[model samples]
Target chain A: MGMHLRACFALAVALGAANSAIAETRLDTDALQLEVLAGSCANCHGTDGRMVGAVPALAGRSAEQLEARLLAFKHEENTGATIMDRIAKGYTDEELATLADYFSHLPATAELTP
Target chain B: MSQPWNRLSRRQLLKGLGGASALPLLGAMPSLAIGGQHAGHVVVVGGGFGGATAAKYLKRANPAIKVTLVEPAEVFYTCPFSNLFLGGLRDMRSIAHNYDELRQRYGVDVIHALAEDIDADAHKVRLSTGDTLRYDRLVLSPGVDMRWDALDGYDEAAAEKAPHAWKAGHQTTLLKQQLEAMEDGGTFIIVAPDNPYRCPPGPYERAGMVAHYFKEHKPNSKVLILDAKDNFSKQGLFTAGWQRLYGDRIEWVGLSNDGRVTRVDADNLEVETEFGTRHRADVLNVIPPQKAGWIADRAGVTDSSGWVPVKPDTFESQQVSDIYVVGDATVAAPMPKSGFCANAQAKVVAAAIASSLEQQPAPTAYWANTCYSLVGPNYGISVAGVYRVTDGAIAEVPGAGGVSPADAPDTVRALEAEYAVGWYNAICQDTWGTQV
Candidate 1:
């Protein structure tokens, strides 16, 4: 029984090691974080930044333009009445740049339309 | 100025944690991707914020995956901005959304039918229409159900007399009517439920809205709040706002001060508290304690707390395989049961499902929630948070999000109120694909 338990433990460790190796090779952490940061904008900006109302859509803009706008909000220079100014302040400059790049690459039009 | 992107590398940060590799572990599993096809059928129950967003994203994530959304209601009334309607700042049609866009625009098979039973083992769902449908993966966003027995003498029958108005539609209209029918100098009582209820700031916001209505229509009327908890979400901001806007019109009694309602007499419109103090009011709004919806309980996914336990990364039920639970039905701690939270969780689960179906490494999951509440027509406040899955649990990232600043300028408050309306339109558009 002890030998059987040891064999099971060994198999689990082996599987864990194999998974770690695969993840290190396959997962792109940079792309994942950028997606996470950009996805947060969807709460008020519409999904993938295709906003329909007064709130401006963030998709399909130049990365430089998006980065400049976010930086302005973050620095409280172009402060808005809403929470965007405060929300922008929460992210680092690097994170803002990543979000800009990510949203800039998404299709400007709604992707879900038939 | 753009800062360099590699300030804090997620890979280097997660390197020490060997468990970070669980993403690929999920990839190695046998694809539930069935029938010799690259795509699989994903059935979503409950077409609220969670289910609707999931269905849309599932199709977007993998055009091959067939998505079916089962919802009993044709038009959905959101609880987020319904308080504004009650306050007379907006109309009912503004908060209502239909499934036309989600159906025609997203190619989702939107079925307006009741989901009766879930056969987890067979991956089949039995609908009220006497038809059974199969799914490779099932998503349940059943929201919440009021515990009728939680408050003595307060049940569905009594709720008809004094509406809870927690669920949006008829109950909301009923509460609005009651407020309108109230006499000039009447007393309005709001009974808030215990911890872990839907939308923590909801009852307080309702109080604000009612007070606003009274101030405009019946200046002599007063609003009383009997709370089950001493401290509430955004308490400082709410109390401060109440003092400024409604003055003495709104009064709050906490649990510590014998404020918890023990029983109710709907006929007399009287509520008896823990100290046996019976207070009679012209109108009473009782929000009872809640649990996972009836379907979740029937599916045997709920634990003792009456909420489904799920893996933080994927929102897959810990009790049942291939079955994911989202929204207020799941035990997503540190994350309040709010519409925004539900939408955020749906995106994470959709991405995970897509990666699994497509035989790719699952992306690391992160979620964010922001809830905006209007104290009055021109007064607004909000709370926001960013969360990540760590050590098999959801944890709020430090210094990521916070409540609206206390004692802000009137201009800031007014701007938040306008943004609140904009947020409602944006979220509705995102969820239902409707142009609000």
Candidate 2:
């Protein structure tokens, strides 16, 4: 049983190393985390932040612009909103920065088809 | 001219790669440790918001992970916008979506087969197609099933006669047909279930929508609600909307006033209340009490409440190893069983699963839920919250989210209605990998 456990542990270490190498060429851990975090916004902002209709789209805006808007909402400076003021208060400034950077880097489009 | 490669979305690139044909390569991967195995098999049951989002995010987090989704239906009808369909504000096709994008763009193997049985100990699932599948991890989002025995004389046959329309497909159409067939002064009755049911504000929304229909078409028609609970989600907003738009056309009876339905006589078109009072109606919609889908019970993951308990952070089953449950089937208290909540939970679980495959500790998980209910053609109300794991259970984050303010201006209400439409489109794109 000990021998089997040791073998499994060794294989796990090797696989982890290989994954780290592969992940370097792809999205790093921080970038991936930001991507997942931004998914919560998709329910209103559209997939990849390309919204239609009255809601403002989040993609392709400057990082500073996104950050400023988020901070305003967070600090309750942006009043007369329905759900955004409450939703923005949920995150810290650090998360807001990460989200701004992530969405800013995404391609901005006027509309997206299925 | 050719499109720039950088302009291609992640889903576009995936579909261009012919990923669906690569299923054999995925199935050939070696099955080793549960969370530590690279390119591990993750079988997701159901193709609704929860399971579809989980499958897509799991593949996005780790492209090598194999996700096979087991769902019997070829087309999915969302419960979110279904009330609008009943209200004649939308069509049935507007709410129906196919699984082609989930299969092609996300590399999810969409199998139109019922998951007949789950062998938790062996980590295998038997399908109605006589095939058995092995998985390193299983994500069950089978939603909910009606508790047929909860109400006397309410069964499958009864549902056919007096549709529940809870599952959001043919039953929705059936109920709409019944309403259309009613006389001008006919009575339309809705029997609401107890708490912890899927879409807490759904019954009230249906009532409002039905009232809207009656007000337009049958001016003398009346809509009656027989609720099993004294209070409900967004009660103030719903009642206010009913009073403003529906007037005396709509009425509600709470359980405290003997409104709880004891039995339903579908053939006679009558419902009996707790006080043995019988109310006959031209149209009866009996939404039976619910429990987690039968698959959860068969897998032995559910508690006595007919829902599966899970570790709040990872959504892993508390009773069974190597299995995760989300959506309506989960005991994720403080977080309603809503589509938005399920989508958020799926992302958290996806990240946790990805981290586990690398043998890393699960990361800090946060989730959110927003439910939008339309009261009239141009009016809407919403409830939202942010949640995190605290003291070993899910709890709402303080001062982070709230419902729509009561007695808002018509402009605000109208804007909310537009946002509701936007939310439906956006959520469909997020979950099904395309617009419905």
Candidate 3:
């Protein structure tokens, strides 16, 4: 009975490690794929991508806004941004280029409803 | 109205008029005047747990303000502990309350009229009887309203057939009839709605009690819960109780498990799922999603979300100052919309309205709530919390509240269930001025 309990504990630890590894692999990405992913994103964010509210549609964001957010996620400076980082984490350099191109192409809407 | 009777506190006078003989309090002229100053008048729109307690305590705190209560119902039949009645352990009459004691003992002006409108600027309320009442302050505690349009092929008309029965009255009686007449090898389907609805664990408890009735009477019937949400309020404890007591007779499906009920064809007594699956049952109980009572919307108090927004401490509307919304009508964040919470809020509103009437500072308010959901006979689970106003919203005091201990002994669990019934009776008695 003691041996059975020990084996079960060991199996649980192994499964935990495997799950972490799967999460790590998903975080590695190319920039070009990231850019391609931004097309569907424009549905929520207006052109020029300044978004609104907690679920803001990002349209007309400044170049600085994109760079600051990306760096914040990469360095873990903004810890509560797990969802955003998860979306951006897999991109390669070329994918990032494509993403920037897609968002930058939009026209910015000025008005917002309360 | 000739030489108004001498003023006395409700507790003292009511205790004096014991037994059922003093039930009709209409003739007793109890005035709220103190020190010969003209007293303010407080008008409460509904006589549920919230409005009743507020009226009861407001009179107790100050015999000065003339309190007038307007409720459409002659007697209130509470939704709480109706499950025990369903289980056949308690009688329906035990859940009914009379407002006569409230009128006679507390000297409350109990008017049985539907509130038609509120002219906030004039500080007056219009009733269905074409009569107008001027109020120093107004408290509205009309309980929940069902969203008949939320589901396709369902509305007030169709609900009469399948019966949501969410609110107790004729619908409750109809649902009870369906269960009683159901066959031994029948299927009972309960379609539960999404969040921000009344009685989170209510549908589950109802399922258990009905199952209990079936276990003894029908024996072969089963209950299937088609829930819109994946995780329920007390899932683990409910599952444990279902497994232990009811065996495999009960089943629950969450949203991810294709549990979302999309439509109901009341003609065929059939329910359709989002995946286009149809389920026909011997008894169909659709506890539809709800909103603030319809009057709130008609009065332009509720936002698009179908709930009224209020200043947390005062329970006064964010839109209008003179009007206060309590009970299930207001958006009380960090507090579940339960009868206990409604009672707590009514107390705060009562104090605020009373204080405002005297042109004095409204006292800082505090509230306490304990919600108990019974899973079976002598088996219960609960969540308790104490609340205070912070940052203009009601927030639960951290470290002051918690859910029932995860592993309570059976005896303790039974005690909690008993206490739950007792609490329900106490609250109903306190609010309506008569015990159910």
Candidate 4:
């Protein structure tokens, strides 16, 4: 999965390789895992990570972008981060990757409950 | 459209249970949900953060699950942001929420009534309207009810003079009016209860907000907090913020300092502390000790400590089968009884129950919470934590989350304040689909 994500990220914002990578990851992860995992981000980021203002909405962001940013925050690579750094470090690299992939597919304004 | 409720048919009308089952929205149980169990009825009592969220998320997790929310209020005035209202930063309407979205958007049946009793043996709940609901699962987010007479000389009648304002809504408005009517230089006393109460950081945050109000309007008025605990949540940050922002306008008294208020003379605006020290106040806000809301007691879920003990992974009540409890009512220590924690716990229970109905293994269970307190309008401080079940209880992940650094600049504080509003908006949206 790391190699897959790295290769997908190397494609950089292009949906092709990243889509395939996440598509494979989705097969083994049950809906319960994905939905419950993503639900956590809803408190601050809005349901499906689609927070409308001040906080950037996570929906539709490329998986690479989301994963890369989450890693940077977790590792303290982003000095300007306030809360995300602390929150990101709580999850393993794999869990963060799952979250990034989870929010990457939703629309920017997905319904709170669908 | 306005709908009428009839006792002849009772499916659901309570918010307490939302903390137990609000996730999954899979269209239909994939024929694997325990062999013909097609997402049975979930009755939720209490429509606050935990219950409303559970109801909404249960539907989200499985659209086939019949979810009914029971809460007595048409509009739930949030206790979370009501402090800001106390500080004059917000209005009552901004903190008000309703069941409109939970009903129309999520297809949940929202019933406005007080849940009276729980027949655990029969899996039924008796409501104030003389109606009853039967459910395959029950979620109780019933919040807290004051332990009347726990504090000497403080009871329902006394609350009229020294308003607890702890439950929000009417008491919140009442306290604000008292603040407004007080003399500019008068002392406002806040009596904070002992530990294991709802919102560990709440009393301190209340002091901060009331001080803010006095700083702007009264200028010379002062706030004095009398606490039962020697230390409080975000103590250092709160103390530092108070000193830097309000500067002597607010003072806190700890247990060692004889800060425990033992008896109250509400009519005379007086209280006696431990060591027989009496103090007078122009405005008295007494937040008394509490227990799980009565329904939890009626449901036979609460322990002698007045809080419901729950399973680490699923928040299911230890005392009752098929009944789950979340929010202030549950013994979820390390996870403070904040709205954010309740909302987080609500989602996990929703997933756990949804998966159970689907005959699947439990879902990935981890929770994160961030609590932002504004010492002043542009002076915000926060504490965040990520938690997981460890040794059969919720424990904070080490090295992952903590209080904001002591050396943050005003610019960062301002940003955090904005983020506070964003958090409120997003979380409110997540729970009841209400925003301001």
Error of 4 at A81 (Å): 1.1
B1-436: candidate 3 lDDT, tens digit per residue: 0011332433224423432222233222222322323357789888887888788767655555678899998878878777777777677788888798788877788999999888888888899999999987888887899887899988888878788877776788888888898889999899999988877778888888988888889899999999899987778878888887899999998899889999998888899899977888888888888999977765667888999999886888888777888887788867878787787787678767766765655655656666777878888877666566777678876654556666667876786686566556455644664653
Off by over 4 Å in 1: A1-37, A52-54, A68-82, A85-93, A107-114, B1-38
Name the better of 1 and 4 by DockQ: 4
Regions more than 4 Å wrong, model 3: A1-114, B1-37
Q: Give the candidate order by descending lDDT.
A: 4, 2, 1, 3
Q: How big is the positional error of residue B131 in model 1, measured in Å on the Cα after superposition?
A: 0.5
Candidate achieving higher TM-score, 1 or 4 = 4
Question: DockQ of candidate 4?
Answer: 0.34
DockQ of 2: 0.29
lDDT of 3 at B387: 68
Candidate DockQ values, in order, are: 0.18, 0.29, 0.01, 0.34
Error of 3 at B337 (Å): 1.1
Chain B TM-score (each prediction, in order): 0.91, 0.92, 0.91, 0.91
lDDT of 2 by residue, B1-436 (tens): 0111221233233333443423343332321223333457899998899999898888777665778999999999999989999899999889988888777766688899999999999999999999999998999998999999899999999999999999999999999999999999999999999898999999999999999999899999999999899999999999999999989888999999988998999998999998998999999999888999999998899999888999998999999988988899999989998999888888888777777765666656768778889999899999989787889889988988989989689888998998888888888887895545
List candidate 4 stretches off by more than 4 Å: A1-29, A110-114, B1-38
CAPRI accuracy category, model 4: acceptable
